[model samples]
Target: MSDAATPELRRLTTYPVKSLDPQDHDSVAVEHGTLAGDREYAMVAKPPDADHDPTTASVGGQGEYVNGKRTAAVHRLRSSLDREAGVLTLREEGGDETRTFSLDDPDALNDYLSDYFDEPVSVRHEPRGGYPDDREFDGPTLVSTATLREVASWFDMTLDSARRRFRANLEVGGVPAFWEDRLFADHGEAVAFRIGDVELLGCNPCRRCVVPSRDPDTGEETPGFRETFLRERERTLPEWVDSDRFEGNFRLMVNTRISESEWGQRLSVGDGVELLGTRQL
Candidate 1:
């Protein structure tokens, strides 16, 4: 294939637990509607005790998911997962102590996280497809390497930091900035694309949340990060990008859904990506 017809998959990242540090993989299977291990485990909040401070605000409130979007405190916790061993290790930024726990022990894990957050919490596991942000299009998220570089330059941050902030599942190289925009069309439509042998339908530009505005390591918010990003994103938007699907400027990567036939397909780094055109959603 010509260079323009095939972009190389430069990286594959998955989050074993939602809103935690990402884990890189050379290859992974497409299970259910998403990458096999992506967001397979998530921490959910439990009811607060009677002594709990009522004045304090929890974005999602009790009985909801605890994530970076709900609270910046989620950023303070760093996670590393050992898939084969089924163990998870968590550490706080700027802290010397690190704790490891077995994935099989939900009570212990929940207690540790609950203590860490100073609230009642529990671990939820869904090995089928995990807790994806966009359930309608639960496939892996896609972004171009050049797009990440461009975004990093705008914030004066490193590429690695930008990657952490965006948390896309697939990164394609050998393409210009915002090249992934071509993967989607107008609203109610989808763009068909293939990576290796797997096919996916790019539904729309991902609607971003508050998580991207803070430092991935620290819970501190960046001054004017969202404002600056919105301004830059609109100014740099490619002409071919379908603006109809973009209700606002708070969008970045492409959210996609997989075909049942493509389930169990293997995707690896260096896989060639090809666009197969668009269709009505």
Candidate 2:
């Protein structure tokens, strides 16, 4: 499809903290490789015995890392960030009690979270970038609603469920199911895809993790469809689709970093997307 015919930016989701409720916005500020105020802070685990700083602990391995994945109890919780006041509001979905405090107050936040989650944790902030799951704190990930709809077909639930489960920063519409996979180097020349007015590079396919199996809202464990899908021996994929970028047969979503243009710019929900020219790499 031509740039003019490309999909529209359907939605924008920002996570102030890792494994917390996402804030939906119509427009957002993008700066220094991350959405402004997105994943600005996170409650990192402080294990009793750890060599390095607990906040720097790797999440996947047996490091001093903890979040909703470590405890489903955390997923039942929701959070809201007041950037101007530097206050964070935490509440339960089906409850009335709400905790509000300064994002800088890690001690108080830690105590509250420890009491509720029954695990020692400390809150930390990243000014340049938020605490991301990617290798380096890149930026917001873009996923297509059409892709969500197709992936949902592999399960019994609705596409809305996948959206909640996948937890993409940006959801696009009016595009094919796997158009994102072909944006860069699915074949031949590498094309640079533009979001709003930004040309994206550092494209990477997000590998599957156990987090997808956990409910984003309730934090309940499911049948692990994402895990199963990755392990499938055979896949009837498209010809232009880049299978080499994926690993473990279960990869989904494209993570892009380094916007060529549109630096210090604002990306809106209704912004049109297109490809300007061939990307060198």
Candidate 3:
């Protein structure tokens, strides 16, 4: 389909952590593009597990390595948050036993985490649910399969390949290709979301990091395909798209927030969402 045509939205998913397995659901409560359980828990490295100094480090500050680059070790341990139990479980890839720690119970969470890594590792609850309050931290991000297919088609790859690179909470199908890049707003009252303290900004195309190279399913490392996608973007898309060059194929929607107060109160999985009109600036 042409980019100008109204694209259909299909499929939605949420990853509770950076590289942990994604949970597929028919519908989800949205608090700024965050599906109910997305990114609620994260695992970090400490003294023995990592060489970095933890004394001066803030909780979750160890996510980024030296510069903006993230460490490979972050991708090595798989973690997930159990919303019902409020526990964060971590285990080595392919390891049989999983250690569960309570996110609500800080002492137990940190103690188990600290022992597991053989270093001082702590856990923090994702305030605003999974949404972060800091502007520096992009709050409540959303992406669509239409956008994924657009980038994948440009690179002569499959939609599945693009999805692996652009991990998101929801993937609406039936939306026209690349329609997500232009979705500034939604007019439907049925589809409302709100986040406390966290402002929702439509993300610009997220720069792909090496994390995509690691197979979320297998935990095996693969060569980065982001460079190929970038090369194709420069060749096919107009210069405007290239003006803000990023590694991945996803685009950002800016300056918008959903009415999330009624989300869990009214909406549930399998609830039909209709797109009335785009939100205007």
Candidate 4:
């Protein structure tokens, strides 16, 4: 809450493989919360369930997979997304080899993934031919250190610990908590990114999931630390809707037409960012 702690810039990271793990980088390309190499591959059900509709299967959100529930198990398989080569690679932990597929060929990707998972897992393209129908993002998803600090303070933990729980693409320094709701970066110039053409919405304060409780490095679950922390500190916030559902830390810029290619063309980590003001929606 002090001005002295606000930083003008911050580090950015992307998890090329969803749920598998996040890879941090000094700077990355951001377009609608997706870094170039993030989440290009997902494990999908090979055959739809009795009432399931593959065509309309939801991509991101809670419990759209087996048993209609989302858990760390879905991401247990290790995968990586490579942008330059337009490829999605997969390998089992401690396995001898890796499997690679081109996002350009959906059929081949689907076949390979299905066989690999011993189920009907498919590779979904990123920026998937101009964003899929299920995408909940409106503009770019940004986070500031101030916001992280506030969330940490609420949870009585260090920022490093919180960062592991709420994974954000851009972790900027020198801005107020939740400033991304009102700021935008234009052509690498920091500008107030308000929700005009773009819808500015905060993610439900993220419900602490088992993923954070499970050490990504060790693959072991700690005893009730995350859930206990949430109960004691973050449970009262507006974003914390209830015991089972907490608001997501990942915010969204909705109803905007910021194209991924256009956004990619303009922004990069370390680019100058400007804060416009509080949103007026």
Scored against the true structure, residue 136 in model 3 reaches a CA lDDT of 35
Local accuracy by lDDT, each model: 0.86, 0.70, 0.48, 0.48
Where's the lowest-lDDT run of ten residues in candidate 1?
49-58
Candidate maximizing lDDT: 1
Candidates ranked by TM-score = 1, 2, 3, 4
Worst 10-residue stretch by lDDT in candidate 4? Answer: 187-196
Residue range 1-281, candidate 2, lDDT tens digits: 53544688999888887778788999988877767877777766664333454346565554544565566776788888888888889988788999898876556777888777787666767766677777452767887887788777776658877887777888888887766776545323445666786666536666666666776778777786655565431363555655445555566777766553556878789988775655655
Cα lDDT, model 1, residue 101: 91
Which is superior by lDDT, 1 or 4?
1
How well does candidate 1 score on lDDT at residue 6? 51
Which candidate model has the greater lDDT, 1 or 2? 1
- Runs of candidate 2 with Cα error greater than 4 angstroms are 1-5, 47-56, 59-63, 186-191, 231-236, 259-261, 277-281
| Candidate 1 vs. true structure, TM-score | 0.92
Give the Å shift of residue 87 in candidate 1. Answer: 1.2
Q: How far out, in Å, is residue 254 in model 4? A: 13
lDDT-based ranking = 1, 2, 3, 4
Per model, how many backbone clashes are there? Answer: 0, 2, 26, 23
Pick by TM-score: which candidate is best? 1
Per-residue lDDT tens digits for candidate 3, residues 190-265, read: 1222222222334344444565555544445655455665566555443333323233443332223444443443
TM-score versus the correct structure, for each prediction:
0.92, 0.85, 0.62, 0.60
State the local distance difference test value for candidate 4. 0.48
